[model samples]
Every structure is written in C-alpha cells, then in structure tokens.
Target: MTRDLLGRHRAVLPEWLALYYENPLEITHGEGRHVWDAAGNKYLDFFGGILTTMTAHALPEVAKAVSEQAGRIIHSSTLYLNRPMVELAERIAHVSGIPDARVFFTTSGTEANDTALLLATAYRRSNTILAMRNSYHGRSFSSVGITGNSGWSPTSLSPLQTLYVHGGVRTRGPYAHLDDRDFVAACVDDLRDLLGHTRAPAALIAEPIQGVGGFTFPPDGLYAAFREVLRERDVLWIADEVQTGWGRTGEHFWGWQAHAHNGPPDIVTFAKGIGNGMSVGGVVARAEIMNCLDANSISTFGGTQITMAAALANLNHALEHDLQGNARRVGGLLLERLRAVAAQVPHVREVRGRGLMLGIELTRPGTDEAAPEAAATVLEEARAGGLLIGKGGGHNTSALRVAPPMSLTVAEAEEGAAILERALRSI
Candidate 1:
C-alpha cells in the first residue's frame, strides 16, 4: 500500500521534491513527540517535519484554534479587516525588536523572503544583493537567486544580481584555521574588499544558521562585525530566520539576537515553526523599508483567519510553556550525547549546532571529503531503529540534521540520542 502511494506521489509531485530513505513510510497520525506510519510502526520524531511541527505533533491548542476559526471563517482575504491577522501581526511586531516595525504575512518562507527582497530593493534602489556562501533561503525564484548553495539553486538566471559572500560556515574555507577573533576580522576584511569592486548593493541577506547547508554557523558576533561594514555602505541587513526563529536556538528568541549588541537586522523573514505545521510566514521591518513600495499589495491567502488563529495559539503555547528553556536544557543533553558517540566514529567529522537545531557531519574516514553514502546509511539505520531524523548539507548532503520539536523532553532526548548512537555505530 505504501509503495502504491509512493508511485502515485511520484506521478503527481515534482521530481525535485525529494523523499528520505530507500523506502519512505507514510505518516498517518501523530501525538506529542511520536508518529505512527501506515504499517502501524511507531517512531520518535526528531526532525519535526523539517522543524515545522515545532511545539509538538497534534498540539490540542492549535487544533482547537484552527477548528473553531474554520467553523466561522477560513479566509476572508486581505481586503477585509481580519481580527486574528491583526492580532498575530501585532504580536510579531512587538517581538521583532525592529524599531517602528511593520509586518507582512505570506503562506510560506519562500513568499516571505520574496516580500523582503522586494522591500529592500525598493528602499535602497538597487538590484544587487549579497548573500552568504553555503546558505539556503527559500524555493521562490527571487529567493533562490540569493541562495548561495548550488545544490538548492537550480539556475543562474535571476531578476537580481547576487554576490556570494564568506563566513557563513566556520569549519571549512580559507579562514577555518583562524581563531574566533581573527576569523571575524578576516571575513570582514574580505567583505570590505568585495564591496570596493561591486555596484551599490541593496542588501546583504543571510541565515544566522544555514539550514539546508547543514546547520553551519560562524563565530558569535560575526554578523555584528558585518553589520558595521554594511552600515557604512548603506546596505540593508536581512536575517532569514525561517529555520532558526521562535526560540528554536534556545539562547535567543530570534537567531539575529546573537548579534543584537549592535542592533536588530533591518529586515527579518520568518516561517517554518511559527504556525506549528500551519502555513504561516512573514517579514518584519522598519516602517520606512516596509512602506517604500509605491503601489498597493496584498496576499489573498496570507494572514487568513484560520492560519492566524493557528499561529496565535501555537505561538502562545510555545511561550507559555517556555519551550525555549526546554530546548536549551534538553538539547544541551542531546548535543553532549551525540558528541560522545561521534568521538568513537571516524566517519563522524563534527557534531555542531545550538539548542534543538543540531547537526552531525559525516566524512570519509581519515579524510575531509564528504561521505554522503555514510549519511544515507545512518538515516536508514535510524529509521530502522524507530527514530526519524533528517539529512542536509552542501552539494553532497552529507550532514545528519537532528532538530526535534522545541517541546522535546529530557527522556525523549535521551531515547533519540540512543537511537542515533546505534545508527552512527552501524555506519
């Protein structure tokens, strides 16, 4: 039955939409941190549907909110005044940390980033954008243009001229050998040199932690240093928090806060977990940048009554439960456990990340080359052990991504870590 469904999915879905494992299981239902497949096999979910199931699976609050809102109205478009929409927007603006902020909602991270690109270009009056190497933004045409990872970027033709920048990944590159302080200085020096030869760029967009690039991040304060350079040149700094926002990083509510000593980003785009599996994406920016567009604009299904209700409920539940603190405590334990397991495996190159968004890079034994085959093996073995994780990285997709829901418990973390350890040893 699962194979038949897989065949049907292949016939209808785009080929670029990849599935995990040699044989994919059809997830039928879920509750808390566990999900059941069509075959009646239960698995502990660590990936959280690519970190979108955020708080937990089958969260009663979000379900009730969606049901109650749908009974009244699912969508009324952006033409009418939507109470839930306004409420969610107000909540987002307050937490955004941008002074005099305004919010615009979209159905997904792709559209959110598309809106951000539009705002920055119009406000700065330039078509050039600077993006970090090994970064993934979104799947939209405009967002893909700024994506520096060739694996996710399908084409070079773009509406905007994008220049790839350095320092997104601290483990590999010319500056990898340097200490934290020197690394920040080197990246900034490289940015200054690049700026000297290019046209005036509208903005420099980056992910605090590169999601599809396997959770790679630079030294703390790297962006703060870059902010200083971009400020001098009048380039807007846009933080794509699609995968790292809403306290997923534990220490910071928003990933940009890691560099907040200088100031918040000029524009912040978020999605993935905010709606807890509902389609909710948005951009927050200063009123000046947000209102720079000359004509009127609206997203017909964006910020609809149903999605807003779900987002509101999910956001409230996350905050009320202090999931950020939970992620910090539980994820710290998981990270330490994984690091111990990785130490015994030569193929495990590195285990890195903060909070619940952790990664284990697989490499060819005794060499720096990526071992995608090893990653694939571990992913399959993990599934066999009744644990569902994810894999992502550069062109080879060689890193194992372990991002569970923020509400993950200490016991669940230990269980998942044990399963992952067995999977790694099998590799």
Candidate 2:
C-alpha cells in the first residue's frame, strides 16, 4: 500500500519537494509525540513536522476550538470585524515588545516576510536588503532572493538587491579560531566595511538561530553589535522569528530578545508553531512601519476565523500549562544526553540548540568536511529503531535536526535519546 501511494505521489508531485529517507513513510495519524505510518509502524516524533506542531499532536483544546469555530464560521474576509482575529492580535501585541504595535496576519511566513519587505522598502525608500550568510527563509521568489544558502536559493535574479552578511554560524567561519568577543568585533567590522561600499539598505533581516543552516548559532550579542552599525545608516532591523519565537529558545520568548539591549526590532515576522499547525502567520511592527502603505491591502485567508480560534486556544494552552518551562527542563536534559552520546562518535562534530530545537552535526572523522552519508545512515537507523528525526545543513545536509514538541516529557526525552544513541552507534 505504501509503495503504491509513493509511486502515485512521485508521478504527480513536484520533484523538488524532497522526502526523507530512501523509502519515505506516510504519516497517517499522531497523538502526543508519536505518529503512526500507513503500515502501522509507530515512531516517536522529534522534528514536529518541521517544528510546526509547537504543542503535541491532537491537542484537545485546539481541536475543540477549531470544531466549535467551524460550526459558526470558518472564514470571513479582512473587511469584517473578526473577534478571534482581534483577540489574538491583542494577545500578540501585548507580548510583541513593540510599543504601539500593529499586527497584520498572513497565511504563511513567506507572505509575512514579503509584507515586511514592502514596509521596510517603502519606509526607508531603499531597495537594498542585508541577509545572513547561511540562512533559509522560504521558497517564495521574494523570500528565496534574500536567502543566502546556495542549495536552497534557486536563482540569483531578484527584484531586491540582497547582500549577504556574516556571523550566522560561528563554529566554522573565517574567524572560527577567535574568541566570542573578537568574533563579534570581526563580524561588525565586516558589516561596517560592507556598508561603506553599498547604498543605504532598507533593512537587515536575520534568523536568531539559523534553522536550516544546521541549527548553527553565532556568539551572543552578535546582532546587537551589528545593530549599532546599521542604526548609523538608518537601516531597519527585521527579526525572522519563524522558528525561534514563543519561548522555544529556553531563555527568550522572542529570539530578538537575545540582542534586545540595544532596543526592540523595528519589525518582526513570525509563523510556524504559533498556530500549532493551523496555518497562522503574521507580522508585528510599530504603527509607523506597518502603515507606510498609502493604498489599501488585505490578506484573503490571513486571519480566517477558524485559524484564529485554533491559535488562541493553542497560545493559551502553551502559556497556561507552562510548556516553555517544560522545554527548558526536558530539552536541557536531552541536550546533555546527546552530548554524551556524541563524545563516543568520531563523526559527531557538535550538538547544539536551545530548548527542543536541537541539532547534531556529523563530519568526517578527522577533517572539517561534512559527512552526508553518515547523516543518512543515522536517519535510516533511527527510523528502524522506531524514532523519527530530521536532517538539515547548508550544502551537504549533514546535521540531524531534532525539534520535538515544547511539551516533551522527561521520560520521552530519555527514550528518544537512547534510540538516537543507538542510531549514532550504528552509523
């Protein structure tokens, strides 16, 4: 049955849509942190469907809200006064840290970012954008144009003249040997040097932690340092918190807070996990930036009633249950356990992340070269052992990505780590 469905899918779906493993399995249903395939195989879910399932699978509150809202209304365009949309917007604004903020909803992160670009370019009256060196935003033409990762970036042609910046990954860059403070200085120097050569940029966009770039992180306060330089040129700072928002980082609610000593960002774009799979995405900015457009604009399916209902329920449940604390506790334990496992494996270069968003990079035994085959082997072995994980990196895809639900329990973390240890050993 799986084989037949796979063949049919391949015949119809775009080839660029990549699948996991040599034999990809179809996930039929899920509950909590586990999912069942079409063939009745149950495996522990760690990637959370690319970190979209912020809570658990089949969350009762969210399901109930969706069902109840559907009974009344699924969608009403932006023209109408949407109670759920307004309520969610109020909650988001309260937590956004931007004073006198305005929110605009979109169906996906790509659109939210596109909205951000429109705002920044119009406000600053500049078309130039600065993006990080190894980052992946989305597949849309506008998003891809700013993306610096060569593997994911399909084209160099773009309406926005995007210039790539440094300091996304600290472990393997030109200044890898430097200490943390020196590394920050070097990146700032690079930024200042670049700013001197080009026209004033409208905005400098970045992911707090590069998700698709092997979950790599820069030294703390890297962005804050760059903020000083960008501010001199009147450049807007846009934080792409699609993966790092809502306390997934253990220490910060929004990833931008890591660099908040300077001041809040001018604009913030968020999606993924906010709706817990309900397709909620939006941008929050000071009224001045969001209202820069002279004419009217609306997102047809942006804040539809059903999705807003789900988002409200999901947000309340996540906060009320203190899932963020759970992520900090369980995820800390899991990270330590994985580090111990990595000490025994030569190919395991590093284990990095915060909260549930974790990654294990595999490299050649004695060299800096990434070991993609080893990553593939561990993924297949983990699946055989009843575990589901993910793989990501810039060019070689050599890092095992493990971002389970924020509500992951300690026992589940232990079990998942044990299975992952065996997978690493097998590799």
Residue-level lDDT tens digits of model 2 in 1-427: 9899889999999999899989999999999999999989999999988889999999999999999999999998999999999999999999999999999999888888888988999999999999999898887888899998898989988879999998999888898999999999999999999999999999999999889888888887999999999999999999999889988987788888988898889999999999999898999999999999988888889999999999999999989998888888999999999999999999999999988889999999988899999999999999999999998898499999999999899999999999999999997
Estimate candidate 2's alpha-carbon lDDT, on a 0 to 1 scale.
0.93
Q: 20 in model 2: Cα distance from truth in Å?
A: 0.8
lDDT of each: 0.94, 0.93
Q: List the residue pairs that clash in candidate 2.
A: none
List the candidate 2 regions with Cα displacement exceeding 4 Å: none
TM-score for every candidate vs. truth? Answer: 0.99, 0.99
- Over the stretch 22-41, how does candidate 1's per-residue lDDT look in tens digits? 99789999999999999999
lDDT for 26 in candidate 1 is 94
> Candidate 1: lDDT of 125?
92
**In model 1, which regions exceed 4 Å deviation?**
none
**Model 2 RMSD, rounded to 1 decimal:** 0.8
